[model samples]
Target: MKRLSVEICVCTKCVMNGAMDIIEAVEGLKKLKTQLRLNSQVDIVTRSFCSGADVCPLVCVNGERMEHSNSETVMAKIISLTSKDVK
Candidate 1:
């Protein structure tokens, strides 16, 4: 099973834009974890120095940045990363 590390910010702008819900989306990845047989270890954190604030509400899976994403987009990224045979 592959491990995934996710990072997010808790800035107010992000919150207003539904960044909090992003956390829920990350949690939702647990379902994919089971289906993909991958260990979905999500780290929902706040980085004061994150320059992505301009992009605000950023979601990164395994060091790859996903931009302007909603919950579903975030989930897709996780599934893509965790799936063993996806090309």
Candidate 2:
């Protein structure tokens, strides 16, 4: 399996939109790492502002954007992005 790296952009606007939870959602991806037995590294950054501020709480898995409003969707996106067979 290819090593996975995840990047999350959390802006102030996103914070107002509940970006903290989104951050947690990305952290949650760690569970999948252990379960999938895949060597993966996830990095989540909370920036004051992102160019995608309009899409605050934006999640990018290996440079792909995953849009959503909740943790479940975030997790699903992460899984799809990192999974060897999915992307």
Candidate 3:
């Protein structure tokens, strides 16, 4: 399957801005995906310092980066990736 790699910045600045909330939201969605048996594509998540320090709480979905990301915005982007992309 084609993996959707999501990288969230958890640096001090991002954490202060609520990066953890985004992480938890993604995890919740992941659980739901499993329950729904949407097992075609997979998500690989990671945490790191901000590559764009000016844009704290950043999220990267499939190499597309977004600044000032929140749980809802990140969730939308991830869920928009269709399962048909599974390899």
TM-score of each candidate? 0.72, 0.65, 0.78
Alpha carbon lDDT of residue 59, candidate 2? 62
| Residue clash pairs of candidate 2 | none
Model 3, runs deviating above 4 Å? 34-44, 83-87
Q: Please provide, for model 2 over 1-87, each residue's C-alpha lDDT reduced to its tens digit, 9 standing for 90 to 100.
A: 455555556666667776788777677667667685545566665555357546766666666765545576777765765675543
Q: Can you rank all candidates by TM-score, best first?
A: 3, 1, 2
Best by lDDT: 3
- Cα-based lDDT at residue 21, candidate 1: 88
| Worst 10-residue lDDT window, candidate 3 | 35-44
Give me the runs in candidate 2 sitting further than 4 Å from their true place: 1-3, 85-87
State the lDDT of candidate 3 residue by residue for 1-87, as single tens digits.
556778888888888888889889888887787554454354656677576468988888888998999999988887777444432
Ranking the candidates on lDDT from highest down gives 3, 1, 2
Model 1 Cα lDDT, one tens digit per residue, 1-87 = 345777665567667667778788778667565666655465555443345457766767667776666687887777667664334
**Pairwise TM-score winner, candidates 1 and 3:** 3
Candidate number with greatest TM-score: 3
Give stretches of model 1 more than 4 Å off: 49-53, 85-87
